[model samples]
Target: MSVNIMLYKITLVVYIAATILFLIDVLLRRTSLGNYARGTLLIGLLVHTATLATRYAEVGQTPVANLHEALSFFAWMLIGSYLLIDLRYRLDSLGVMVCPLAVIMLLAGGVIFYEVPHQNPMLDSWWFPVHVTLAFAGYAVFTLAFLVGIMYLLQERMLKTKSFSGLYYRLPSLDILDIINYRCLSFGFPLMTMAIITGAVWANQAWGGYWRWDPKETSALVTWFLYAALLHGRLNVGWRGRRAAIVAIIGFIFLIFSLFGVNLMLSDEHSFDAFKSLR
Candidate 1:
């Protein structure tokens, strides 16, 4: 009914259309359609950005206080990151993998329309937006890394078997994918680290403690360590290709648990229902 909601729906439809175009391009080996897919994706990104801007205008805060908002913001970050990568690397084929992910996140957001009350004082803190934005941005890039890792494995398998299917020809080279994976890790790791540090500072400011060892916090730490080890292995032990890909995949799994699983399954300061009084 509202303009923001209408824009959100339009963005979702555009994303779905873009995803279909990308899928067809990949499956039919029609590389010429790549431009059309990218154009559609850009349209969706623009619409989605407008939707977020409208929501922020209404709320006067980061539009991520509830699950729906969080998911939508995460999806936006994912698509934005993918577009940057596509621009830099000319990897339009990756859109086939990424567009569907954005669609799913948007769909999940659409499923839950109950607006969370904005009375929580945490929304007033300057650190809230910074922390959540950086954290989800990190998650978004890590997700891209995960998808690239999967593609790397599939491409590697095809090469090993010497089977040159359409997929084999369509996907980028393992070297290119590996480079993307490492670059994503390099970008995401620091964001995650800063998120944790900001989170701790916010927590201490709000709850009078720097470390509560909440389930969400612990899981976040685990995720950080997983990526840290991967980075260490890459820089020191020369982990590359399959080893690096596997680590990235596994790290993303842990990240999913940290982001959604902990919030859903455990009661913590971070849980949606567990808001604390600023007093």
Candidate 2:
């Protein structure tokens, strides 16, 4: 096997180990288990970073042109985001959601759609990395918000029914989850805005027009508007709790469809095949 593949497999193992530890910690509320999980996830992120770096060395450009590369990088960024959030919130419970998603992303990227690196001139632009980095970072933050949204809803329900479960015990209070949801929206909005702006610039350079109204573009625009409205509601009207959580979940679902579905299932200018057709 190649060095990249070797490292990816190792990282996947580490991520799985971390996820299991996190799950155990969630069930037991043991600080030691949470610490081990966090440490293991840190090691996995380092190894995954090496994998991306090595892929870049092998391929002459950023390693985000294909599903495997993009998903792996997405998982890497999610782990990084989770770590940063952990530094402040001590959100050990968040790991139960984040780590499993990371593991699934790594598995889907590495196993289902592994592709050999091929130089694509379309991805040669400096804008490619900049746009993708911002886009994925924004998505990572939104995913966190989405998970926190779920937690908020669960906590709310448990409180209303007065039937608290073990998972309920592990979850943060509704107030904290709502705060996290708003904070994530606050951070993700700007990154997503810049992603769209840089994307327009890149699209203008690559395509003949600034807007193609392609499926990806349309979905991105809609997703942008969705979050914009959510933020607007929070800032202007003071929307929070259940309403905010629901919107977050809806927005992320649309975002994922834009990211994966449009690329693989639907034809769009963003797809590799479409890129080749343009050339």
Candidate 3:
């Protein structure tokens, strides 16, 4: 096995270990285990970074044109974003939610898809990487927001019912989770907007049109509008707490469909095979 493949496997193993540790930390109330989980997560991130860099060196392009690379990159961005948030918020328990997601993404990327390196000239444009990176970064943050929203709903329910368990105590307060959700939306929305604009420009340059109304493009626009409305409601209508969380969760669902379902199931110019044909 090549070093890149080995690194990827190691990263996946580490991520799995980290996820288990995070779960144990949350369920068992082992505060000390949280520190170990964080350290393990950091190691996995470094290894995954190395794996991507190696693949990029070998492929001579951004390593995200294929499903394998795209999923791996998305997982990497998600973990990186979560670490940053944990650093700022000290919400180690959030790892219980995030680490498993990272593991699943990595597994989907590294295991489900056969790893083959091919260069597509259609992705040769400078804008392609920028567009994809910003778009996935936005997705990552929105994912974090969605997880926090779920936690908020659970915590709210526990509070209302007076069910106060260890899980309730371990999770951050509803207010804190809401603030994090809003912040994620604030960061992700502008990135998504820029991604759409860049995507249009790239599309026009490559395909001779700015707006194709392709399924992927249309779904992306719809996802964008969902978040836009969420933000608008938050700022103008003073939507917060449960309402904002619900909207954020709903927006993320649309985002998943835009990213995966449209690309895989729908016929569109944005599909991976279509890019090869364009080349």
Candidate 4:
């Protein structure tokens, strides 16, 4: 096997170890173990970055356009974003939620990456990278927001019922979690918009049309509209607390479906060519 494959395996092992450690840390409420988990996660991220760097060096371009490559990028962005938020908010429990998702994405990469050809042809312009990068980053942020929103709702429900469960004690305050969710969405929505615009431009360049109503395209549009409606409902329709939280959860479900579901069933450019095994 190649050195990159070896490094990739090492990274996956480290990530799985870190995830187990972090889960145990959270279950035991051990701050020291949480710190250990962070250290392990950092090491895993470093190894992951090196793996990607080697792949890019071999390919001689950004690896954001293809389905498997995009999945790998999304996993990396999730780790990076989680670390950033955890640093800012001291939300160690968030890692327990995030690391598993990243691992799944990375494992999925192991399956799909092989089906992808070794030689990635340039798309004739740099806008392809710009568009995909922004979209995946936006999706990453929204996913974080959605997780926080779920946590916020759970914490709030516990408080309302006066039940001090272990999960409630481990999670952050509802106010703080909601603020984090809102802030992430605030940043992510605009990035999603830029992605859409860049995509329209790229589409016009390649396909001679801007709006093709493809499965991935339409699903993304619906996801965007849902989030936009949530924003409007929160601002003007006086929807807050549970209602807003529900909207976020539903929006995220749709987004996930758009991300993986469409790719699995639909035959779009964004769909994975090797997705048969993914099912």
The 0-to-1 C-alpha lDDT of every candidate, in the order given, reads 0.90, 0.88, 0.88, 0.81
TM-score of each model, in listed order: 0.95, 0.95, 0.95, 0.91
Candidate 4 lDDT score at position 195: 93
Candidate 2, TM-score vs. the true structure? Answer: 0.95
Ten-residue segment with the worst summed lDDT in candidate 3?
Answer: 270-279
Better of 1 and 2 by lDDT: 1
Over the stretch 35-104, how does candidate 4's per-residue lDDT look in tens digits? Answer: 8898899899899899888767665667654566777789888888788888879787789999899889
Cα shift from native, residue 213, model 2 (Å) = 0.8
Q: Clashing pairs in model 3? A: none
lDDT of 1 by residue, 73-136 (tens): 9999999999998998978678999999999999988987735446678678988999999999
Which TM-score value belongs to model 4?
0.91
Evaluate model 1: give its lDDT: 0.90
Please list the residue runs of candidate 2 whose C-alpha ends up more than 4 Å from where it truly belongs after superposition.
272-279
Tell me each candidate's RMSD, in Å, in order: 2.9, 2.4, 2.4, 2.2
- Error of model 2, residue 77, in angstroms: 0.9
